[model samples]
Target chain A: MREAALSLFSRHGYAAVSMRQIAKEVGVQAGALYNYTPDKQTLLFELMRSHMDDLLSARAATGDSGQDAMARLEAFTRFHIHFHSQRPDEVFIAYMELRNLTPENFEVIEGLRRQYENGLEDILSAGQSDGVFAVSDTKIAAMAVIAMLTGVNTWFQEGGRLSLEEVEQIYWDMVRKSVAANP
Target chain B: MREAALSLFSRHGYAAVSMRQIAKEVGVQAGALYNYTPDKQTLLFELMRSHMDDLLSARAATGDSGQDAMARLEAFTRFHIHFHSQRPDEVFIAYMELRNLTPENFEVIEGLRRQYENGLEDILSAGQSDGVFAVSDTKIAAMAVIAMLTGVNTWFQEGGRLSLEEVEQIYWDMVRKSVAANP
Candidate 1:
């Protein structure tokens, strides 16, 4: 049901989709959806919150424990690109449906997003302290790096002119230099 | 009518907003709207295409004529941040409503966007040739820089913690170092 809702919400706006449509897409009664999510808002919030949770959990799993700041930053870049690329629908909803989220729900999702961004900022801060990265502001730098990396989803296709590995390499090189004290 | 439509389209996804709602928002009857635009899709396409045209024109006005590549790049970074920050709704629709454009409209808008991006790429390519930048792929670098800069609209508030000037300086610093042959 959540999968059906996600597809509908992403293709059609969340507000445009409803219980009946989602239920129809799921091949179930509209009442059955209430058994699962209770309401459309819940469904939207769950999808966004879960995406953030999954992102953080996955980041934890990809931890470069005891690594240098540079290495950890590279790990983050790779992990972010790979994770977001695989889940186009979730990524689309996560960004596009923010306005539709209730305030409390938006906070939860935003908090999780901040935590994820802070992970990268922490790396930048550590690198700055270690005199490896000459970032002016670690917070802003983290956001800049993130937006740059997440942009892969906009144009990346499986069999494009460049392979994912090639694209990754290109972005990684730019990411490394973007914050490097001496490239 | 375009303003009313743009606000509606950006707030509600283009697919969700109807011609009746737009006409009401513009203080006109539904039948009267056809005199201005043939249909909702045309309104969306015009809003999007005009945005691109305006962006390109603004960019041209901010062009770094007879300047070095580094300065030109800096001008672009600052100009892009300032221009996009002011038109939050248009920027939002420009990114979010692409999925709703007709295929032909999509291509026209996409082509205009490419032209805008190519402007930045041209700067990067020139910088590379001039030995000021070491960008491996100028195309990807332009996109990365753009995505990073445009992200300001996602979180920027009028009286936020950082002034626009300050934010511009921070991003410009990162952009310069990101592409610099030697940071």
Candidate 2:
């Protein structure tokens, strides 16, 4: 049911989709959806929360925090691009449907997003302390890197001119230098 | 009329906004809007194209292409951030409403976007030639830098911790370092 809602929401913005449409897409009665989610707002909030939960858990599973900041940062870069690439629909909803979320829901989702961003900021801070990263502001740098890495989804295709491996290396190279200590 | 349409489209996804609603917002009869545009899709295309046209013209007005590559890039980084900062609605519609554009309109908007991107890519290529930048792929580098700069719109608020000038400088620092030749 959530999957159908996600597809519909991503295809037609959340405002254009409805419980009935989602229910129909799921091949069930609209009333049945209420059995699962109280309303569309709750459904949207849950979808976003689930995505964030998945992201944080996956980041935790990376288990490379003990490594030096450079290595850890590289892992994050690759992981982010790979994870987002596979979930284009979710990623689209996560960003595009943000405005549709209720205020309280927006805050909760923003908090989770901030939590994810802090994962990168922490690495940048550690690298700065180690005299390896020359980042002027760890928080800003984290956001900048994240936006750049995720931008890959806008144009990247599986069988395009460059393989994902190649693309990842290219981005990793830029990411490494973007925060490296000035020579 | 376009203003009202842009506002509505950005606030509510393009799919959800009706022509009648746009007309009401613009203080006109619904039929009156047809005198200005053939339909809602054309209205959207016009808004998007106008925004891109404004961007390209503004970019041209920056008039720093004659400068050294590094200086030119800094100008672009600041210009992009500043220009986008002032037009949050257009920026939002431009990104969010792309999926709603007719296929032909999408191609046209995309081509204009590529033209703007090529502006930055040309600078990166020049920088690489001058040995001031070490970007492995100018195309990818351009996209990365633009994405990073525009991401400022997602969080930056006026009277916040950083002034626009300060934010520009911070992003310029990261962008400059991101493509600087490895020492």
Candidate 3:
């Protein structure tokens, strides 16, 4: 049911998609769908929450923070691109469906987002303290870097002019230079 | 009617907005709305096209291309942030509504988008040729830079931690360093 809702919500605006349609997609009775998620809003919130949780846990698992600042930054750059690219629908909903989430759900999602932002900010802060990254504001730099890396989804295709690895390397090069104190 | 449609479409998803609601917003009869746009799809297409035209004309007015590559790049970066920051609704719709456009409308919008991208790529290409920038792929770099700069809209709020001018300067500094040959 969650998958069905994510697919539908991503393709159609959340307002345009009916709960019945999600049930149809899932091949379940409409009443049965509520057993999983009480409502479409809950489903949307769960999808967004799960995406954030996955992102944070994936970052933690990388153990990149244990490395030097530059190494950690590279790990983050690559990891972000790799992670976001594989989940186009979830990424779209995560970004585009916030307005559809209820106010209370919105706050929870925003907190998760802030946690992710802080994770990246911490890396930038570490690098700044090391005198390797010369960003005037680490918070802004974290936002800028994540925006640049996540942008891979806006145009990237698997069999496009470049492979994912090539794309990753290109972005990392730009990101690495973008922050280095003396590139 | 067009203004009403833009506001409605930007607030609600395009698919979720109805001509009747737009008419109500404009305080006009539902039938009268058709005089402005034949249908919701056409309204959406026109809103998107007008946005592209406005962006192109605005950039042309800047005459950034006439400057040296580095100066042109700075001009582009600052202009993009300033322009996009001013039109949160348009920027949001332009990115979010592309999928909602008809196939033919999509083609026209894509062409215009490419033209805007090319304007930035030209600067990056000029910089590359001038040996001032070290970008392996100017096209990707152009996309990356534009994404990063336009992303200012995502988090930047007036009277926040930084003024718009400060934000522009910080982004410009990062952008300049990102592509500089010897940062």
Number of the top DockQ candidate: 3
Question: Can you tell me which runs of candidate 1 are displaced by over 4 Å?
Answer: none
Predicted candidate 3 versus true structure: per-residue lDDT over A86-149, tens digit per residue: 9999988888888888899999999999998998899999989999989998999999998998
Query: Whose lDDT is greatest here?
Result: 2
**Over 4 Å off in model 3, which ranges?**
none
- Score candidate 3 by lDDT: 0.91
lDDT per residue for candidate 2 within A1-183, as digits (tens), equals 989988999999999998999999999999988989999999999999999999999989999867998999999999999999999989989998899999999999999999999999999999999999998889999999999999999999999999988999999989998899963
| Per-residue lDDT of A121 in model 2 | 96
Report how far off residue B29 is in candidate 1 (Å): 1.5
**Model 1 chain B weakest lDDT span, ten residues long:** B59-68
Question: In model 2, how large is the Cα lDDT of residue B47?
Answer: 98
Candidate achieving higher DockQ, 2 or 3: 3
Candidate 3 lDDT over residue span B56-77, tens digit each: 9999999864678999999999
Question: If you score just chain A, what TM-score does every candidate get?
Answer: 0.98, 0.98, 0.97
**Cα deviation of B59 in candidate 3 (Å)?**
0.4
Question: lDDT of each model, Cα atoms only?
Answer: 0.91, 0.93, 0.91
Query: A2-56 in candidate 1: lDDT tens per residue?
Result: 8998999989889899899999999998898888987899999999988999999
Listed in order, the DockQ scores are 0.83, 0.76, 0.85
Q: After superposition, how far is residue B182 of candidate 3 from its true place, in Å?
A: 1.3
Docking class of 3: high
Lowest lDDT sum, 10 consecutive residues, model 3 chain B, at B59-68
